[model samples]
Target: MEPTRLNKYLVDAGVCSRREADRLMEEGRITVDGRRAVLGQKVTGNEKIFVDRKPVKKPESIERVYIAYHKPVGIICTSDPKAKDNIIEAVNYPDGRIFHIGRLDVASSGLILLTNDGDIVNAILRAEGQHEKEYIVKVDKDITDEMVTSLRNGVHIGDDRPTLPAKIMKMGARMFSITIVEGRNRQIRRMCEAVGLNVESLKRIRVMGIKLDDIPPGKWRFLTEQETSALKAALV
Candidate 1:
């Protein structure tokens, strides 16, 4: 392999995006040939590289893969082989390694983006409020008007930070649909709890323009070019 930028190498390794790789390098967690790695340092993909003390190997070549998966409840969204029931195992893609773009709790299910394109992962996530994720949540009981108002108005969540006002619509006596731009861990559950509601179930159906559609739980398919383009456009 020819010499490659350190950040690009990290991205190709499925560890993180170029920007994040730069951050890691700056933090002194990355090294090349037993020395601390510097930003923009180049590697021939043959020299010893380590991230946080663990050896790093660049994949021979990575196929840019993007999939919209219908994650089932109980499947963890991690790359850990020991997880046993991780999203990667659930999808069982025979191609190269891919990582979840974001996360869904083990108890929740629905649409989750899986991809090997580290660039897209960083772009979408770092874009912050630029994209929206939609979910339908069912609470333990019917919600009260006051609770609805508070939830709609935004509430202090687990992080003790105020949530962004979300577009929420009541779908049934005990269910509602919410669209939020932030991807805080268990944000929906925390938001509901702040308003005195218990989340009985949570399932995401959309992220930006991509929809789960009729894809059965535990199954996945490659995104159409149009869908892929739409997703990339959101990053810009």
Candidate 2:
């Protein structure tokens, strides 16, 4: 194998993110061939590596891990510079860098998908005209039967195209559920507001065939082998 950037090698091997690996190097925690390596160094497969005096393994040899986090309402789905208390901080995955498959807003939460497999992220997020997300929303006031019918058929929520026909289930006088294939920013909240309902709470309980079930708020678990395949299949 050819050489690669030191940080990329370390991140791919599950040691840390590329940025965190850079910190480890700056702190004199990484070495190449028994000599302390500096920032931005590249390492070939032929070189020996150490981190904190222990050998560093090759990146391609590591297995990836995926997780399902039942994110709480306050967390955002991101790994950007401003992502304090976001999904990345919430799970604190100790191995390879895992990122959310799509995103959930800061005020809406449940079943956020995390994966180190970058391909899966693209598969789930960018697949045009494929897959769907389902959310259960509670509002502060009752919705008239007429309003429910309006949302089901379509409403002008400042979008050029009418929303795809949604599956709306009336749960109570002030509660209902909607399933949508294409996601837009604050799509659910805006959809409700368009018909004069104030969204009091929003929780995504299902994505395709996966359900949030008993997963607690603010914690995460690995996707079962079956779940991984099912999730990928759903995107098709």
Best by lDDT: 1
TM-score of 1: 0.82
Error of 2 at 154 (Å): 2.2
Per-residue C-alpha lDDT of model 2 across residues 23-78, encoded as one tens digit per residue: 77898888898888898898876788887676766767768887878989888776
Model 1, position 26, has a per-residue lDDT of 88
Per-model TM against the reference? 0.82, 0.76
Candidate 2 lDDT for residue 218: 81
Q: Residue 84 lDDT in model 1?
A: 76
The candidate 1 region of ten consecutive residues with least summed lDDT is 54-63
Measured with C-alpha atoms, the lDDT of residue 223 in candidate 2 is 77
| Deviation of model 1 at 37, angstroms | 9.6
Model 2, runs deviating above 4 Å: 1-59
Return the lDDT, model 2, position 191: 86
